[model samples]
Target: MLHLLTPDEIFPSLPEVDLERLQRRGVRGLVLDLDNTLVAYGGREAAEPVLVWLREARAAGMRLCILSNGRPRRVRLTAERLGLPWVESYTKPRRRGFRAAARLLGTRPHETAVLGDQIFTDVLGGHRAGFVTVLVNPVSRRELPHTRVVRAIERLVFALLLRRGRIDREAWRLRTS
Candidate 1:
């Protein structure tokens, strides 16, 4: 079955995340989601938190790349300015995007982690492609209208999980690799 994990389980608290722990988890590469996961939809650049995370990840011998269902303009601009590799117009829940990102990482799906803001697309797609899926809270609520709808679905699922006690606040971790 597809695993349901909250942001805390997937990445630890944003403040507590570190490259060393990720390395211990055997994640040598990362394919990060844009927009809400990294920044808001209207975000013009990576925020300070994201910048710090990127630096730490790189410093710990981890590679990073951008993969999103967003336009080439946003992806390219961010990727270029950050000097990181990326795949724009990358369709999630599809192997193409994950495959491209895997190629860029020079790592197999099993060794890579896909961090994102949605479950249906980000988690499902990453799971399908065989990468470890990490779900995170969206940074802001100002997402595209379509994303808002998906988020509504997520809330319903989260509520169900909460009722069933499937959500573990202390040990927020799920792995398919």
Candidate 2:
């Protein structure tokens, strides 16, 4: 059960994700989370770096879409800013959201990758949907109260993984590069 929640890859941030490597691995589409995955929660738009990365990924023939649990208005605003399609109030960790995202990208689940900051939601949902799952550190510490509780549990899981040597110390560190 816990294993299902584990991410296939872990990065400190979106920029640290090796898009080229993903492309090489035959990932043709991306299902990205909005808050904390692409930007800090409540951010109105993606940062310049993120926008550039998305453009490059698209140029490389990767389809992209934002799938988030946020309200439609918020999701639409962010998607419009990044010029990407989106599905809002996605109710993640549910296979429906993942399936919807894959459909939007015009790809099969196995050929798509899902990136986000949560394990129970993004990772679990992606894994359940048979998509490659990447977990990134949250961009900001500020999160909803419920998410804070989940973060505590995530920290415990990380500690256990560290102790068992399932992951390296670097996995817990925020990577700037």
Candidate 3:
């Protein structure tokens, strides 16, 4: 169960992810979390750096899809602004949405990567759906009240994982090899 919530890799931010490395590892598509991952919660647009990184990933022949639990209108508009397709209003920590996003990208589970800031949602769902998962630190501390509560639990789980050497706090890449 803990492994289901464990991210395959960790990066400080979306822009820090190595697109080339992911491509070499056969990651053909990216299932991205919009809020807190690409942009701050409630922000209208992703920062310029994130936009540039996304463009670079697309240029590298990697497909991208926004998979978010946010409202449909907000998710749709954000996707449009980023000029990407999106899967919105679907609950996370569920395999259905992750599979849908993978299908949307025309990639099999092994060929897709899910990137988000939350472990319980993105990491767990991606793992359940059999896709590689990458976790990034949240862009901002500002978040929904319920999310704040979840964050507390997330911290506890992370601590346990860290202590057990299942996760490395100092290492940006969590690969065992």
Candidate 4:
């Protein structure tokens, strides 16, 4: 399941990915989910650590762009503030948003990676779009009640994978990190 990343997943919290690794994976572009993945949903600006990561990723020569399901005003303001290329009203778990973002990035599906905090939206959409998918744990535990319910479902999905012996924590971290 896309919910689980490789064992190498690390923290603060980068999977320790950089340009060399991305190139090795044949990835030249990135599609990022805004909330929880890059910043907390309620945040107006990305955290300093996230900004540093973004800079590091860019310096490594990766073409990064943001794709979010948020409304036009929200997404646009965030993108403008961050100086990032972005699309608003992204309907994740569907191919349209991914496809549009890919086109805007001038990236082929084969050379793009889509990363987000939610498996149902981010991972599924990226996987369906034929890009490499990455699912990161959400940064915030405090969320709306609706979001909390989805988080529960997400955990259940991961737990099922663990019980099936498809994932072991250490192995998962190593692959992702």
lDDT of 4 by residue, 97-174 (tens): 899889988999978888777767877788788888765666666666887898778677766666776667753453
lDDT of 2 at 12: 73
Q: What is the TM-score (0 to 1) of candidate 4?
A: 0.85
**Residues 72-177 of candidate 2: C-alpha lDDT, one tens digit per residue:** 8989988988889997755788999899889999999889999999988999899999999988888788789999999888888877776777666777564222
Best by lDDT: 3
Q: Which ten residues in a row have the lowest lDDT in candidate 2?
A: 168-177
In model 3, residue pairs whose N, Cα or C atoms come closer than 3 Å (at least 3 residues apart or on different chains), thus clashing, are: none
lDDT of 1 by residue, 9-124 (tens): 45532324555766777888888888777667768677787778788788788888989888888778877887788986456778789889999899988888888878877787
Clashes of each: 1, 0, 0, 16
* Candidate number of the best TM-score: 3
Query: Which parts of model 3 have CA positions greater than 4 angstroms off?
Result: 172-177
TM-score on alpha carbons, each prediction: 0.85, 0.92, 0.94, 0.85
Name the regions of candidate 1 deviating beyond 4 angstroms.
Answer: 4-8, 12-16, 169-177
> Candidate 2 at 85: error in angstroms?
0.5
Query: Whose lDDT is higher: candidate 3's or candidate 4's?
Result: 3
Per-residue error for 86 in candidate 3, Å, reads: 0.5
lDDT, candidate 3, 2-117, per-residue tens: 89988888888899999988888799999999999998999878999999999899899999999999989999998999999999746897888988898899999999999999
